[model samples]
Target: MHQPNYIILQCYGYEAVFLECAYALMSLSRLYKPEELTNTEIWVYTDKPEWFDRFADCPLPLHFRKMDAALIKQWRGDIDFVHRIKIELLLDFTETRTGNILYADTDMVFLQKLDDVWNGLAPGELYMHMQEGKISEKGNPLFRKLDTFLRSGKAIKTEGTPLYDLYMWNAGILGFHSSHRELLQKALEYTDSEHPKFPKHIIEQFAFSIQFGSKGNIKSALPYALHYWNMKELRQIIASFLQYFDGKPWADLVRYSSLLQPYILVTEKNMFLQNRSFTEKVLNKKWVPAMPNWELLEKQI
Candidate 1:
């Protein structure tokens, strides 16, 4: 019944979705006794504390920690600048827990209590979402590089080969016990390395997948978490959850003790950088809603 400390990394523009996921987790936490979740700490690692004011009225028990923008801006690597902050934050958690760490992404919504995963946690085994592709999966430039490396004698792919699966585990949800500092540190180093000249996409994720993949010590195929890629997929999952609760309302859904974890286990955050106008122009965007008309409310009347 060790208390679990869940860490969430976020910044401003995502305040809307971030608050949604946070409250969902808090609501889910009500299902278990406080002792069951010893020291349930929600570390909101952010670069902007002002955003805390927006969520100040939220019902979740949140602890805010700000990061120095100056320190992060100078970091070099293929990992997204924001992701680097997350990695660094993990280091902080490591010192406190020594090994017990459950990392989650802000975009995720939890559907079930994670006690199953926590109770099932192995001492030395790290839990990561299994990559849906082999190393040779097309559409990713990294695969091309791995292929070239394999052909160049730098890597060998034989039967039972470690590189055979070559799957890239999603970083959205990662669970690693303490005492794996060496591996985590190595991952950080590999990610920091600019050599081998890898592609810029999913850099940290690719490195982490390789580090864990080569060791062959990962806990795969667990029904612990799901990663939704975009708003469309996210909506579908939410719809399914809503249906599962017998078409319950969103606010009422919060009352279902069994529905909290799944609703809060979100892993992917949408970085809304694209201009809304650009997206609107690309598609006629004629997906009209069949719900209550809000246009009348915007009228001059």
Candidate 2:
């Protein structure tokens, strides 16, 4: 199985950020064999290598590439769009390396083994987490706003890509051959041109979507990885878990993380979408996406 090198672009700052990546990384330790990992490179870009000292023995051999404050600021580029760092990193990787590159966000957790996931991608294809839908059709309040803005013919400088029909793929997982580096540049250009006009946080995501769509074979990485972008409450849960798991070995962390499910995938999220009476649907709202509570989750662990 020929899996590409993986990149996790994160700077050391918040403890929740570290815990988010740490939990996601444990998914690797649990799924891949030691020998398989020996040949694979998991490049972790961060300012603090010591933050992950306890996870040193993980089967996924983490190679730390330090990023200082100035470098990170530069990567954010002139527009100061934070997500642009990912494109810059990909471009930087292609300058020196020739293999395939798989860039994942800190919020993602792998559901399949790395080799098995790699097997599913076609040669010369690109990937994002999954297709959310065309912006014109999406029911999301934010997408609705963007759709209205696009319909008014504001930024016609997007080089004739169908702004309304562009699908908003979640940018949590990106896989592409290193040779396709030019697309990243185009994505950056799209971002720079559109962001000043629209000023939404999702411009970078849509930019990558548009550029990669030009390749004609962008697959969904949803089956292999879960991007818990909507699970905002998880910060507290992860913090509690990190405190509980302090000083534990990598194997122990892997064991528990393997059992842990993304709260967004649980039944509570679905129950909210269930059919309801006209008045009840208008007046009554659900309190939560009820993941297993900490007490119950601890018992399960």
Candidate 3:
């Protein structure tokens, strides 16, 4: 029998994001053995359910929680933070469901079977994308600024956890049990308080990092999944693919999408940054060949 757990995602807004959500769901099916989702339900909290009509006959049960404008606006709250909605949506579902909950960003893909990750989640532990170091570090200049900003106000909310000392984990993936749902509220609180002052995008991410890490044993989900947030420019390419295969059968999309190697793309982007030739960096205002030729992306590597 399947485990009474859940893997959920929230996708709303424009066409590109919706397609990315579709790609994320499709990646789950590309796993070995039972084609993934063998033990859990995949709940997509989205505004456009009809956009996912292609998944009607999926083997595992798919749940759609309809999200309207007002609900989304409410989730954003007074802070108007876009990422805040992620915590809110997860909190809302945990209210009714009682099992292990894994929340993922739309811009992510699975690297292994769902069981690989599922086996790691339990009641007492929490999970995020990966550890991104502390705020006081010089790795990211903005985070250094955040360290100064939070330190001045003595704004560390959670007990025993100092803001400067805490590690800022990527909030792309969150794993927890219904028993620990209260941490999501703390995450929202941290986001609302710091975002108005810092006004940086990583505020919500740090908030989740703070609360979830402080209160529970936070684990990294990077071993089983890869979040392609750095390569967001690829969204337009995904949009083109969606347009070309708009009404095609689900199997065709799956086969074609299997060619996507987000980790390799990220590696290539990093390598370019490190080994940027003088012509590419200084002389050529307009660069030469596009890495991983898009013309034949879906057809083959």
Error of 3 at 209 (Å): 0.9
Off by over 4 Å in 3: 1-3, 32-38, 55-57, 157-161, 244-247, 277-301
User: How do the residues 139-173 of candidate 1 rate in per-residue lDDT, one tens digit apiece?
Assistant: 46666666565445444334665553467677776
| C-alpha RMSD (angstroms) for model 2 | 3.3
lDDT to native, each model: 0.53, 0.75, 0.77
By TM-score, the better pick of 2 and 3 is 3
Ranking by TM-score: 3, 2, 1
Best of the candidates, lDDT: 3
lDDT, candidate 2, equals: 0.75
| Candidate 2: Cα lDDT at 38 | 58
**Clashing residue pairs in candidate 2 (N, C-alpha, C atoms within 3 angstroms):** none
Can you write out model 2's per-residue Cα lDDT over 79-137, one digit (the tens) per residue? 88788887787777778776567788787788877554454443677888898889999
Worst 10 residues of 1 by lDDT: 264-273
Superposed Cα deviation of residue 62, candidate 1 (Å):
2.6
TM-scores, each model vs. reference: 0.65, 0.86, 0.87
Which one wins by lDDT: 1 or 2?
2
Q: Candidate 1 or 2, higher TM-score?
A: 2
